[model samples]
Target: MRALLLSLLLGAAVLPALAAAPTDPPTPPVPSTTDGLIAQPWYRPHHLIGQVAGGQGMVTVGVGYTTLRGRLDVDVLTGYVPRKYSITPMGIFTGKATYSPWTLGLGASRWQVRPLSVGGLVNYTASRGMNASLDGKYPKGYYWWPARSRAGAFVGGRVAYELPTKANGQPRTASLYYELGTNDLYLVSLYSNIKALSVADILTLGIGVKVDL
Candidate 1:
């Protein structure tokens, strides 16, 4: 009877410890937020594009980044233009940054719209006889801005048609964007000759597409 009582006591003592022991090890928490939507490295580019006009080129290929949940963007593009469009046949490079204050999502659809965007850009044109600054051929301060490089401001819109993703991964996405803008030289000309120039005459239009990576 003593041995039987001792066994019963031991069983009772172990019961609480067994109940407290975890059957499975603890797991690291899965993030419940939209962190997955961000790129692995913050500085990595998020998109690529092809564009026309905006003083970069008649046609250009570019890369871009999106931030603030797609509220802001920046892009760099490069391309070629014929002598007919410039003083000489040239290669052009451009950098642009923009902010869209609002994005309106279409109901239950994969469409997202950024109805307004404002931005600025700088463009460099490489020509055989051309440099950003004027050559000795021109007197000092004859021209207000540089000859081979131009800076401009723009306003625009973008409409994105998000593609459906398969069960395995991230959502596919693409967008169409267009902008109208003016350069420093154009503005100088406009204000200097207001009677001869209209806003339409000073503005340049750019149409492009962006593909998310």
Candidate 2:
């Protein structure tokens, strides 16, 4: 009887010790490829953009992606020009890419400044009333470029104000920028009439805003 009782007590003690003993913590789960892409989806745009008169259209609005530590912005925009400005009301679609080499933050202020920004854009305008530059009436090589498509380059600066952080802990910002640009056609005209055409004559002014999403 005593032996049976002692054996039961020993068994209880040993079972508790074994239960309390810690095993190697489960190996942390290896992050899968799907987990890595959750931070930024391919279809998500980083910000929204709107602009006026960069030779794109009278008013342009679009979505954009901010990459390269905010130094690069790629935007796709659509714009409209009133009939008063052209033979007919026109719709313009533009793809633009801008790069700013440096960004300076103001001393303890939310304001920031980008001293230099350079970019290029390609745009297509659709209008029924506009005559085609390279039509059957003209020889194949007579007109070197299409009337509806334009390519341009610009240089500018930007001023931005930091906004409150979002619920997801993402920072937000709003920026205003300006671009002075010239289109390929304008550049060609300047090249042909260097004495008559001034740099200011060919330049187009554009102002825009960007808001983080």
Candidate 3:
């Protein structure tokens, strides 16, 4: 009887330990904040993009980096135009910096919209005999804007849908965007000849899709 009682006591002692033993695998840890999402490779780019117009070229493709929870974006794009379309087959390199201060969530549908985005860009187009120099070819200060380089500004909006990301805790998103922009030369012309050129005459439209990694 004493031996059976001792066995029962031992079983009771072991019961608590077994109850505390882990059964299912440990739950995946939740990232406490957005900064932790890219802490490992902080400098890695966040996206790849394809665009049209925007005063660079007929078609543009690029890579981009996003910060501030996808609010600030910087993109480097390379654009191309066919020889049949223009003077030559031109290659344009453009760098764009955009500020999206706000994002509006669309209910629980995993969709978001950026109502307003403001940005600026600079572009360099390369081609034979296409140069950015007055270089005494047309006398000094004859042209205020460079032939090869252009500076522009834009305002735009975007709609994005978020996708499930398991490998990296970061959100994956695909977005479509549109922008209305004008070049520095266009703006200068508008300011000097207000009645002659309306806002639509000076505006250029850009459309694109972006995929967040």
- The TM-score, computed over Cα atoms with residue i paired to residue i, of candidate 2 is 0.80
Clashes of 3: 0
lDDT of 1 by residue, 1-213 (tens): 999999999999998778877775778654322323453577767789998877778889999887665677888899788888767788999999989888788998899898999999998888885655566777888766678888999999999998775233445479999999999988989999989899999998989999977
Note each model's CA RMSD in angstroms.
8.4, 10.3, 8.0
Alpha-carbon shift of residue 133 in model 2 (angstroms):
1.5
TM-score, cand. 1: 0.76
| lDDT value for model 1 | 0.82
Candidate 1, which segments miss by more than 4 Å at Cα?
1-37, 131-133, 137-142, 165-172
The reply for model 3, stretches above 4 Å from the true place, is 1-37, 40-43, 131-133
Tell me each candidate's TM-score.
Answer: 0.76, 0.80, 0.80
Relative to the true structure, how large is the alpha-carbon lDDT of every model? 0.82, 0.89, 0.86
Model 2 — which ten-residue stretch has the worst lDDT?
30-39
Compute the lDDT for candidate 2: 0.89
Evaluate model 3: give its TM-score.
Answer: 0.80
